[model samples]
Target: MRFFLSVSCFILTFAAAAAAPVIEPPLPMEKAFRMEARRDGPDIALRWQLEDGYYLYREYLSATGDDGKPVEMSTPPGVIKDDPGFGSTEVYYGTATATLVAPTAGMLKVTYQGCQDGGLCYPPTTVDIDPATLAQAMDPAADGPVSPARPQSQAAFPLVSKAAAEPVDGPGIRISDQSANGVVGSLLDRGGVLFLIAGFLGLGVLLAFTPCVFPMYPILAATLSREGESLSAGRGFALSLTYVLSLAAAFSLFGVVAAWWGQSFQVALQSTTATLVVAAIFMALALSSFGLFELQLPSFLRNRVAPARGSGGSLASSAALGFSSALVIGPCVTAPLAGALLYIAQTGDVVLGATALFALGVGKGIPLILMGTFGSGPLPRAGQWMERVRQVFGFLFLATAVWLADGLLPAGTGLLLWSVLAITFAVFIGAFDQMRPEAGGAARLAKSAGLLAGLYGVLLAIGAFSGATDPLKPLAPIAAARSDTTTAKKIIKDSFQSAASAAELSSLLKADANGAPSLVYFTADWCVTCRVIERSVLSDATVANALEGVRLISVDLSKITEANRSLMKELQVIGPPTMLFLDAGNNEVQASRLVGDITTQAVAASAASLKESL
Candidate 1:
């Protein structure tokens, strides 16, 4: 009876098991995550589709070419998550694509890893693609990196960056198309060899006309004119060549060092003491040109020092002057120069960057070379005309000295010096003296110029007495307003608070909670461009109105102390004239950052944009 019960029970259990449903196994890893690759012109495009309950690790996804060299790639931002296996990491769900610069001509290889939700992690998988296959699969629609979906909050997505490399921290806010430096940098990275050469050289030619380069001309002219009748066209060409080469060398060496080391070496040379030293050099040169003294070695050491005057003193002096001028005098950072510096800083490519800078110097020197060669040809060879020419260059040297020292001098001293110079020039040209009836056309022209100089000098003197600072706008302070209460515009005082360090700046930024935007201006007393922007853009009526509700902060790098250096490094400030726009949350509105030159319209527009974003 018991045996019969057992058999019946076993049969019943078997029948119950046969009736139960079954569970299916998970799908293969390949089926869970699918990848596609294609050629997008000179670049490679990659796309991955993740099935539901599946995600790919961003750090695990990488690509390389047949040459076994890793291809440079840029991907969209991914979702941040804390994983049990990997701690905090970035991962992608749904679908996404990555863009890579095409590597050496060969097969493309891609590798990635994925994991199932609440389940096992898959091992890394590699996919090899033939170059021919990729070429045949070229997509006409995909020209660049596809824009990924981003958060709607302005504070979350400050700006979309199109840089080749992904931003490691925040959005990679850089000088863009609106900046000439950015354009040049872009060309350096993507343009053809011939195109880059022509473009940078042309840019150098254009920069030659700027105010920064004006002082160099007078220095070179004085050197050649001092050589007088003995200078041959070839000799003049040789001296000019030496000067230009030295200048180019200085720029290249200093620029590369600055970019590599992340410090403004040229800017450091603009300190008050340094400027005074350079001014003293110019003054000595001017006195020599004025026939006040000679620039010769002492008699005791002359024979031992140099054998030939032309080969030793002239060429040596030219070289020394060129190098010094490049360092201290022409410290302006134009677009092309900034571009080359940017490239060097980004790539750490001293060789190519130095070469480009050298080419730029050569382009700027073309006019100087021509002038040096032909300047002596027009001279009268040791006569009153030659003496007059020498005297003119002496005045120019004196003017250059004054300009250099202006920034370091007391307020209004520059205007006084200029007034004295103009008056002296008028006297030298016989402005008030009686002229003979037989005087020629040239004499009348000189008298006319002298009269104008005398009149301008008188104006400058009056303005100086009235405590004016700007030589260009001498009488601005003294000029009566149309109506003080009715027509006078509101004066905007310096509203910027100083930030001594990065920590202090951060605290200040966070302390304000009112939702008003903030403007952080990076400026330096030694920076000429900074002064101009402060005078023109920041002080504009429209800009001031736009920034009415904004908190203003200034960080002065003029002294370059350790604290300032740390602040600049943390802020990623390459040089002055850099403005940072911040929203109420203290997050940088990356798109609104300004580098190099700025205009009133741009400043106002940036402020408005920051406010709107907030």
Candidate 2:
């Protein structure tokens, strides 16, 4: 009787603690997901010591800069679990280790996601540490056994993932969730290699126009644009070739890694300090563009970094810069790339992933290659215009850095800093000053541009003072109204109901809605695309009007947990902004399942499909 009473009292206390709205002390990052490494002859021995009660998602295990390149290094098979959130996903509990066959002198960018027994799941995180640093972190047992390698099981990692492997009672085309993303993924699933390659290559060409690819351009343009002699077509060809090859290699490697390991670069390190490092590097490069300091390395550092001032030096520099840019800039996923990545994640096939990425890289580099070839014949003759041109690029780089840093910093801080940078940039561009009456067309244009910049800068400053976070919305008057709001729209928020746990989501999916259909919206803090949808499409009143009576289940993936992760897997959703629809009978309404960002009209049309009047 005494023992039974003691157990019952312990259970009561646990239940009470679970019921309370209390925040538990978080584990130190190092202890929670500690990364350690050691040298085993030419090989590198790496281990992640997960604290007790914390589990690592095997699919999230990632390796970067292994084998002297950003290759998609593999991990041993993990213990399988029928997760409540993501059914039949593999996970590693307590401790896990992997080996790199031939380690190189480069940054070891590791990414992994884990959850505690408390039900909190961390967003995918990345750690870029030197091999030496990792070695120091986990000193190998002086008498420890060398890490012996093991082969991965083919059955365990079949081409098609078991989560989606099971046949569902849905339309054949419903495999992928969104339009472009879903369509391309469906084609790949149908096994058309030529279609996949041709489509992704075209998509790559399109992605080149996006902001993510901008960082690589200035570096290459600056390199090719020397004052003394025009870059000969032959040299330009060689340089562009080297740059393209290196970039393709890096991106292809990244695709393979993402396929094999299931982590996108953005998902891996979004809002992390490593992203800040990339911003800092670009800031330093911007200083060089301003002629603050020569980019050429010191004599002693030259040998260590790259060859000095010759054809070989130029080629080496081009290749290194290209590879480095691909690794750093990390092109944001567009529809085509997202489709390719989706295919890779579901299949874990590095070969197809690498090929698609290679094609995409080639397409992205086409403009760079063509411009370098034909645009080199301009005669600037090393005058004032040249310096001005360099300064223009300098300001561009600074602006880009500020833009990249925006996600990491708080909204107010980002706008304030961006405004200050804009002011500085304007000063260089001749803002707050009139041009000489006899100045050239270009000079007059510069002054005109600077005048506009100055006006915008002042507006930004005012917006900052008034506590407006969005740089685009630089008005003090609307600040209070905006500050009082939350989510896409007040009415939309009311329409959407939050599902915090797997049980809740399962119930929502299973619950009978009489005759109404339900739409499940997936979102997370790190998902920028989700924000875009909210700001651009979902905010439209017509779109919201169409969803008047349909059930809206909003799943907050930011609060990561075992149950949540499993639910995402069950939904076959790789990341955020997934819209899953279910009919009254709890069957997934495959016809209207949208992935990523959809247009306002597209959403309205879908809603129109749902209305009884239709």
- Number of the predicted model whose lDDT against the real structure is largest: 1
Question: Which 10 consecutive residues of model 1 have the lowest summed lDDT?
Answer: 151-160
Q: Tell me each candidate's TM-score.
A: 0.64, 0.64
Global Cα lDDT for candidate 2: 0.62
Q: Give the CA lDDT, 0 to 100, for residue 380 in model 2.
A: 41
Off by over 4 Å in 1: 1-185, 192-198, 230-235, 260-262, 296-314, 342-347, 373-376, 480-493, 545-551, 582-593, 596-614
lDDT of 2 by residue, 1-614 (tens): 44336537744753554354432323434557666555544555556767787778888777667453554455777988776656788888866766565445666666777766544465567666555543211223334333244332222111221111233422221232343235445545554555556666777787776666776677677767642364577667667767876887788777666545555444554546656776787788789878888665456656654443432236657777788677554535455555566555543444555667777887888788876677656624367866777777777778777877776666678778878887887798886676678988987887788778878888888887787766777784565566876544323445677886667865665555465566778776556566667756776877777677777888876555666655654565555666766555445544565655567887776666555332
CA lDDT, every model vs. true structure: 0.69, 0.62
For candidate 2, list the clashing residue pairs, or say none: 85-566, 85-567, 86-566, 86-567, 121-560, 177-595, 178-595
| Residue-pair clashes, model 1 | 0
Model 1 residue pairs with clashes: none
